[model samples]
Target: MQPCVLTSTGGAPVAARFHAPPGAVRGAVVIGGAMGVKQDYYAHFAQWLSEQGYLVASFDYRGMGDSQRGSLRRLRADLFDWTDDFDTVIAEALARSGGAPLYLIGHSLGAQLPGLLKHRDRVDGLLSVAAGSGYWRDNAPQLRRMVLYFWHVLVPVATRLFGYFPGRKLRKVGDLPAGVVMQWRRWCMNPRYHVGAEGAPVREKFEAARFPVVALSITDDELMTERGTQVLVDCYANAPRRVERIAPADVQARRIGHFGFFRDQFQSSLWQRALTQLQAFRSPGETRDPADGISSRVAPGLLTAH
Candidate 1:
């Protein structure tokens, strides 16, 4: 793995790890999960993709992981900053790989950010794991949503006064900024805000650059709900998209939720499946390990527009 850096539109420096095939590269970029997520968690998957003939680039968004630091905290970052960081990473990946066709594998919130990047046309395809369209659906219950909203309102004040919120100690909730939290809430409550790459707002000119897309969701994901996943599917403006659901019992190694898909004991299984699907699109006849293939049960299908 080679370490590298790139500058975001915000002027923040980004850090990334690149894995190249021994021969000429196929193409792919593997993005880690949200806030404070480390690429080591997906290290095995990175190496595996490389071995399968892909030049995979994995990175830390600015203000997170090995990237250079700025004045922001995770919970404090808004969507715009994240989008800029993603574009920087993609640009770096293009430069390093000699500007080959690029496929993207984005996990959780990271999945959404890539689609939001200004130059998404550079992408040849997308694989989104545990994708969320930014809303909770009915799972949060009206009362709980209100309480969470109120808590989000206080997060900024509390962090400012106390220097930080409790971090990730809150059960099942991610460590995030009050501003990001509120922005997400606003998107979720409004009928407009889309989740994952499906929800990100794109410029009209870039809308025609539809590449093949695969969205996989796990059953019983506490952080991402089926309803939310369905909503995301409904909003996608792309053709030839697939959405697959994985049951916990089928999750080979560890029972994965939102974060666990890339971190669980059975990560190898998930990677194998996803890699197979990705490789299937590389050329007309490239084949990858089915063990690396996404579950047959959770396979993505043709995505219909609403």
Candidate 2:
């Protein structure tokens, strides 16, 4: 992987990395990182995809990771602006692919923002890992109390006093821009998530998404419960969607939590399964159904909007 920087349409310098295969490329992929997570977290996964003959790009949002130029106390980025960052990266991936099909591997907050993509039609398909609504009530039962504390206490207090979320100092997640954290808190507090938080225009945009999406939810994920995952998938009212809930035992592991999917430890078992599903979309007129040829056990179809 080589270091790169992307200039968003809005002019923010987004930090990124690119992985290219030696031989012919089958497809181009843009790996979008989760909230408070840096692009480097997905570096190994991106390299693996490149080895499989795919050109892959992994990027960090403007206010996070290498993209941030200075102190978070002065930055003022919001979650919606992330759509612009994604647009820039996707455009770069498409340009590099020389017109090869482009796919997205979006994790957590990475997955939720795709509906806002201005070039949604350009995407061949999306693979959403551990994607779900952030509504606290919809989280895993065991984590709900913690979620409440985070939503009601930590976020507000920290953002108010520090001018940004001091997640890194608190050892919660990672440091976040004030606007991003507050906006996220608002969405998570709403039952409808971003749809409710942003109102009708956002809802319409989500309904406009018509691509195929495969949402992978881990049963052991303490952050997102089954209902949390389902709620986000349901928002894509016009997408052909499938939800696959995998238990750790199914993969011969004791635990695969919210962040484990991208770890190198699962590169052979879980990661390979994801690659198969992604590669399935490489050929024209290929099966678009998420269930076809995927090794992971498929849960009941979540929401398939016609």
Candidate 3:
């Protein structure tokens, strides 16, 4: 793993890390993180993907984790800037890919906003984990229980008081720029989510996306529900997609929440599952989409945690 810094299109610094295999490279992966998550949080997964002969890149959005330089108020970024950051990371991964198939492994907000990418055509596929539309009405039971207060009272009051959302200190969401929190709150409150709130242009972007997607939805996800996940995936109307709704028992685990899939303990199970699904997309040299098949290669071991 090598630490690096990337410059966003907006000319802001973005923190990132790159992982490469020792031998032949079969594919490339860009791991777009959940909101407030750092690029370092995915180090283990990136290392494992590299071991599988993939060129893996992970990055932090501005005002989150290592990308946040000094003060939150000093940062001028919203979700749009973060999408630009993701685009920058993807571009780097694609350049280093050397014609190998490049996939985006997006988590939560990471997946939701890919429609905004200017270079979506360059990506081969997307692996969405616990990603959702963030419509409060369709959120997971836990989030739905408190959605009103979070959107109406807390987010507004907190952002105004601090000039930023101190999610890390509050233990609500993670820390975020005030613009990000406000814009995100608007998305959550709207029944149609970001697309509905942002208007026709955003919807057109989603409609324009054509890359195949593998959406992994966790039944035990504390924030995203099956409906929410599907809603987000459905936004990519022209894209061929396979949505896997998995409960803990389905993978022979005690519990796999929204965040648990990234834990090292599930490396052999969920991680390998992701690898197989991405492999099914297309290998290094070939270009066209394969059978969209994942089950034949998903081993029996996936049913048991060894």
**How many Å off is the CA of 122 in candidate 3?**
0.7
Q: lDDT tens digits, residues 102-149, model 1?
A: 777888767665546665666666788887666534333443455455
> RMSDs, each prediction?
6.2, 4.9, 5.7
Q: Give lDDT tens digits, candidate 3, residues 1-306.
A: 877888997788888888998887777789999987877779999999899999999988986777878999877788888899999888887667666667889999889988889978767778999998898889877777788998899899988999899887899878899989999988987878988999999899988987777799998999888888888888887777768888999778999998999999889899999989888776344453323312112222222211
lDDT for 58 (candidate 2):
92
Which 10-residue window in model 3 sums to the lowest lDDT? 297-306
Q: What's the TM for model 3? A: 0.92
Determine the C-alpha RMSD for candidate 2 after optimal superposition of all C-alphas.
4.9
The candidate that achieves the highest lDDT relative to the unseen native structure: 2
Q: How accurate is candidate 1 locally (lDDT)?
A: 0.61
